[model samples]
Target: MRIYVLSRQKLLLGLLFLFTVGGILAITQFTLTTPSLVRTPGTYYMANTPEKVVALTFDDGPDPIDTPDILDILKEKEVRATFFVLGKAAQSNPDLLKRLVKEGHEIGNHGFNHDYQQRHLVKEMNQTDQAVYAATGYHTYFYRPPGGFVSKTQLETTNRNGHVVALWSVDSKDWRNPGVKQIVDNVVKNVFPGSIILMHDGGYQRSQTVKSLGPIIDALRARGYRLATLSELKTLDSETK
Candidate 1:
């Protein structure tokens, strides 16, 4: 009977040891992968300044039709905005992508595909970064999930990669073909100093966005707001390690 009891205790102790080891491994893995918590929103920082500086960012772009028009407007205005280009679109429109680079505007990785709920965001991000790097020979440190849906892991991965996840403080919803007047009014009403305004130069039916661009720029400039890219608006200095 004593032998049996000892054997049972030994089994229980072994199980306990295994469980403890597994728990430790899990915790260690999490610690190793989890991004630093210093910046909560992970990637993009909304400018906290009271200065009349706003970022104008376009997503899912370099579309053949709308992008060129938008670029023309930007050039005419002599203002720059961040373009978050999808890998597939960038693959299809290499010249547009190059044009964006030549125009002194900043480019951000919008993923290989526009997957807002991409389960493999980190994996896709690595691939996307590589693809963009290969194409432009320019390394980008900015990312935005499709539709702006991001998980904690996605945020952590981006932050670890020294990339900022750009989010919009104001959306014109030109994607929905909102009236030009409405798009204009929306910006006039919603934009504030340090606002990251969202518009799109790609995706479906962006003609409305193209149409709205001129007036939006005119109105904003008239109001004395300087529209700049995400990089220009948000000052990201190199961390002294």
Candidate 2:
């Protein structure tokens, strides 16, 4: 019957639309932020080097309370890290930002604002890089998109600006305030050679992050991994090569 034929066509169209959306999500889930250009021109972090080196990168912070505590731990540990600080936070907490630089930690840009959803709208990649450099007086060559969200344009533009698009292999999810023990457990369990671990020092109550850092560092070192800032890790890798 004509009615039956129309029903079948409608069902087929609905199925096709669902399939198209699912397919796009599947591809974007992993490859969404990846640049189309296969080659990474200037080296940022070594992808898979065999040294007992790991990079600890903190995003979204420089919070007055948490940032100082995080810095204290890092100072005690005598280890360096990479702080992907937001520009707005940097402007507000100039001393904390300066202290991060003074203490030998490598600083990277995490944009002017911490809006996890705003990728390329407020500030283009060029503007982002300039603002960070102008505020911090350090040329930021590494970028972590806010909230781990990035579009094709953001990734391509960041790469074009000579900044590597940073993604984390280990996420503490400490923002969730998972008990400090759980956060340490998660990080220790997931870390591997060449792993870039993500944590935050700048926003909200990050007491857990500060608490977890010492144990995490001790555990990772006990497991034969040495923590390095991004630049130091890159340098160690380059020296060997």
lDDT of candidate 1 vs native?
0.79
Let me know the TM-score candidate 1 reaches against the reference structure.
0.78
Candidates in order have lDDT scores of 0.79, 0.77
Candidate 1 per-residue C-alpha lDDT over 1-241 given as tens digits, one digit per residue, 9 for 90 to 100: 3554458889999999999999999988775443221234555636777789888889887789889999999999898889988888887888887788889888988888787577777677777777667767797788887877667887787788767787777778777787998988877898888888888888787878888898998999899998888877776322211
TM-score of 2: 0.77
Clash number for candidate 1: 1
How far is 12's C-alpha from truth in model 1 (Å)?
55
Clash counts for all predictions:
1, 2
**Residues 1-241, candidate 2, lDDT per residue (tens digit)?**
3554458889999999999999999887656443322223343434467788999999887789988888999999898999988877776777786788889998888877766666453364455556556655777778877766666776677677677777677777787899999999988998888877889997788888999999999999999998998877766654446
TM-score of each: 0.78, 0.77
